[model samples]
Target: MERLQKVIAHAGVASRRKAEQLIVEGKVKVNGKVVKELGIKVGENDRVEVEGIPLEREEPVYLLLYKPSGVISAVKDDKDRKVVTDFIPYIKQRIYPVGRLDYDTSGILLLTNDGEFANALMHPRYEVEKTYVAKVKGVPSRESIKILERGVVLEDGKTAPAKVKVISFDKRKQTTILEITIHEGRNRQVRRMLEAIEHPVLKLKREQYAFLTLSGLSTGDSRELSPHEVKQLRALVLHGKNRA
Candidate 1:
């Protein structure tokens, strides 16, 4: 269930504020009764109409995309750069990225039309795990690795403790591949954390989000999430879990 105004807005009737105005003006009805109250909620079975026209609610869609570097993680970009939505033109619903990925970063991304689901996953209290594999400029010292695992101070604040592991290292190139998992979703956080350790990121890619991964998907490919997967995610957030 959702607020009537929000429901109307999600149905593409009008914006939420406009929906409120229409409701107060008696232009909106639920189950054949004019509703003027803003707090009124409607469920799936509820019949809603605006200005005597039946409202058509869009069914929610959940998709996982292997977002390639350079593609904007937005509905549209002001500079007209290609966006994640452009890759899935076959989908009709106005879905959006659950969270953003940097233009220079690539990998697992989720997009959905269900605002509640997105909010639940994004809420700080949920502590949803996000894993990233990064190739950095140099091999970090044990002290730097410890600093990352213990939480590093950033411009924003001290980040929560992370799960960090050195995946591999190239002696000749002086680069190290590391896997770091964290719950926070700060902008360019992985890069910032590496910078804080004096090992700036050379390249980065998200490996996992919560339990979701880019197992079969390739770059720029996407697939609709199964009903069970969606249910599992909702349950994961609802039950809460330890911070990464």
Candidate 2:
């Protein structure tokens, strides 16, 4: 037997939270009976349906979104702010973001309803590498770069070592594009690191995460991840540390 919400999520109905909402709203039925309780259990012999459609356990769905600036990386925002879900129209499942992007930060963000996969990706032990491109106020000195590459003391103490590469310097634009790769997903770590070195980031965009990239997707748009992409992401979570 499995929890109803878990079954609903595994069937690609929604995230566990949303599935519970569906249950509470009397939209989900099991074995031809409406179920409104959150912790109701079900077995393989039972039948489940949502909104009149019989639910089937789908192959786990994954998506890569080119999250635009000024959008919150949350499934729902109480303040009525623009959320990443606003751009994903075709995804009927209640998938949530694997990690997060700041309201003003844009780049590759993963969305999925697979609970175990989400746990593995977000867990600190995984240490999945995330790469970002930051447009900063000024070109950082070699010493500054070294300090960032080595590690800097944030309010939370010393940060993990990150890989910093000065991609290009534009004197005319008075901006520098630097690439930073880090394994830990601290809150606003990239921006804080740059701030610590006196290089405030003007704009930031994540370019890659482990095996996934925001290659073909445009800003404010998303695509359902192919099966191969989903498998690759799962592999990254399962074996990322070994390769890292």
Candidate 3:
């Protein structure tokens, strides 16, 4: 048995906090009866609904999207721009982005309906690494790369050690392509780090998250994770938790 709001949240109707608000607003009903109290417990036999739509059965969905530049990473954008959810319109169960990707950035993005799974991946203590390919204004010297490898001081504080690899350099454009991998999720950390060294990022794309990659995806395309992939991700999250 589970608390009514918890069951509703597991059903993907809304977040737990929002589900509690629905109950308080008299918008939740169970088995043809309105339920306004927060203390009520429910079982599998109960029929739960918000407004008039019956709650969906709990089904954890894991998706990988090749995010295209110009779309917001959130479920919705107040600025009226396209959002990540627009790609999965056929999916009825509510899902949310595991982390964030800026509007101008594009790459591998994970979304899931399982809150615990999402939390495990995003938690700072888990130290899950994210790899980004940054195209910057100039070729970085070995000393500059070493500076990044050691740590760069940002406005928030000094960054943790990062892995930096010079992928290539273009003479015509006078730009360099770099592979920078870090475990931190600070806002615009990659862009900020490059700027501090006098090289501003021209474009940024995340190439990998943990062991997951955007190998089979194209811009704006999405697909459900295979069973094997799901198992691998859960194992990684569990392993991270144990280490923490």
Candidate 4:
């Protein structure tokens, strides 16, 4: 069963908010009866109609879109900037990003229409790891890496300890490539962490999330999640709950 407004929006009639307004106006009918209640739930065989027209049900969609830097991570950007949704024009479902990516950061991003799966993935207890490869202004010494591993003080609070490894150093360019992984999703965290250590980031890109990797995916491309991949992701979230 699903919320009437959600089902209506899923049929591409209108957004969820608009659907709610339509319901309040008594324009929605289910099983040949008007339903004005906001909390109403309709089961799979229920006959749902909006303005006497039947709604078409679409299967849930899960997709991975390589978010390019400068694209906003929102369903619709008020600034008229391009959004991640623009990258997947072929998909018709009202899918949303699971979490978020910075407007200046690029890499692996997950989009889905399944609210339960998104909740499971974003829920703090899951401790899903997000990994990034960062190019910094200068090489970080062992002491600095240790400090990042211990956690840094931010405006909100101290961040969770992160795993940091120096991938390479280029003396000529006075830069270092570091692979940093953290379980917490803070705003501009990787760049902030590097800046806190006096080695500002030149470039940053998320390479992995949980067990999912951006293998062979160039920025701006997207693909549907395979059934097995979806199963594994759900299992990971459920296992986290079991442990809790």
Candidate 5:
């Protein structure tokens, strides 16, 4: 059994938060009874409806795509650009990206049809780590690195603390390659963060999300995640919530 809102979300009717709102607004029904309570739980045998539409739950699918630069992260794009879903033409489930990677940023991106799992992993409270390797224009000073480690102010607000390391320096080209790990999913965050420290990124690629990596996959390659991997990810967010 699961919370009614969770079941609604799992069916892809809405996000968990939105599902709660729908329940409160009396738009959701369980077994033909309008359910306005947020805490109600339902079993697999229970029938659910949202906005008078019966829920149809699809089997969840999880995928890791080594996204190439210049492709959209969404299932479809308004401007008709190529999207991440285009890489997996054979997948039948209606999966969406868990979070976003910038159009120009490439590497480890997760796609899933499990709405509850996606919500948990993307929730701010869970703090799922994302690691990126960036090639920036200039070598940063130790003080600048420290500033990043502490947190930097952006247009939206101050970023949370980040883990940054200088991987290499190119004296001839006057560029630096560094790795930065952050949990926030702000738009253009990695680029903006480096820009805050006066080292604009020349190229950026995400290398990891949680413990998952783009180890064997090349650009535009993808694979279904193993069951164990999915279990581990779910456990990670659950454990994170417990710790929080």
Candidate 6:
């Protein structure tokens, strides 16, 4: 048995903090009896309801979304702008984004109801690699490439070393597309790194994170991860420390 608030939170009804409030408000019930105690225990066999609607234990859900440009990576937007959750109308679990993507950037984004899994993927200690394809204003000089390989100083401080490679160059357009791999998830790291090298990024899209990819997924579309995919992700989080 577990605390009612924790059980509700684990079932994705709400966060643990919010669930406690609901219990105090006397809006939650177990086995047809109103339960207002914050520390009340609940078992898997117990029936739970909130606001008269029966609640079921939520199964873990993991999804990959090809987030399009102009959408914020949040569950709710106070500004009323489009959010990543808008594309996932069918997901029943109260999941949240694993990490953030800039409003103008596009590509692979992971969403899950498993907080432990999300923490593992987002934590820098795991050092999960995120790959991005960036279209920059101009080709970076050899020295600049070395600077990036070693590490470049952003406005904040020196960034961690990143793997940079020229994917292709468009001479006529005066643009160069580069593939960059970084382990840190600092805000706008790719764009800032390119700016530091005097080559402003025109477009950026994350293509992969660790073992997850955007392959077979289209922009603005989302799909539940397969069982194998979910298992692989959990393993990545649990064993990432050892691997690192």
lDDT of each: 0.90, 0.86, 0.87, 0.87, 0.92, 0.87
Q: After superposition, how far is residue 223 of candidate 6 from its true place, in Å?
A: 0.9
Kindly list the per-residue Cα lDDT of model 5 for residues 101-158, writing each as its tens digit. 9999999999988887888898878889999999999889999999999999999999
Best by TM-score: 5
The CA lDDT at 3 in model 3 is 94
* Global Cα lDDT for candidate 5: 0.92
Alpha-carbon lDDT of model 6 = 0.87
Error of 5 at 198 (Å): 1.3
Error of 6 at 140 (Å): 0.3
Q: How far is 174's C-alpha from truth in model 1 (Å)?
A: 0.5
lDDT of 3 by residue, 1-244 (tens): 8899777766656667778998999999999999999999998888988999987776788999999999898898888899999998977778888888988999989988876567667777778899999999988888889989999988899998999989899988899999999988888889999998989999999999988899878898999998898888778878888997
Q: Candidate 3: minimum summed lDDT over ten consecutive residues — where?
A: 8-17
Error of 1 at 133 (Å): 0.3
lDDT of 6 at 17: 72
**Which digits, one per residue and each the tens of the lDDT, describe model 4 over residues 1-244?**
8899888766656667778988999999999999999999998899988888887777878899899999998889888999999999998888899889999899999998765577668776877889999999987889999999999888888888999988999999899999999988878888888999999988889999888899878999999999999999989888888987
| Segments in model 1 whose C-alpha atoms lie over 4 Å from true places | 1-39, 43-56, 241-244
Model 4 per-residue lDDT at 212: 88
Output the better candidate (2/6) by lDDT: 6
User: Mind giving the per-residue lDDT tens digits that candidate 2 earns over 1-244?
Assistant: 9999888877755667788888999999998999999978998878999989998765566888999999999988999999998888787777788889899999999888776577667776778889999999987899999999899999998988999999999998788999999988889989999999999999999999887888777898788788887788777777866765
Q: What is the Cα root-mean-square deviation between model 2 and the actual structure? A: 5.7
Better of 2 and 3 by TM-score: 3
TM-score of 5: 0.94
Off by over 4 Å in 5: none
Pairwise TM-score winner, candidates 2 and 4? 4
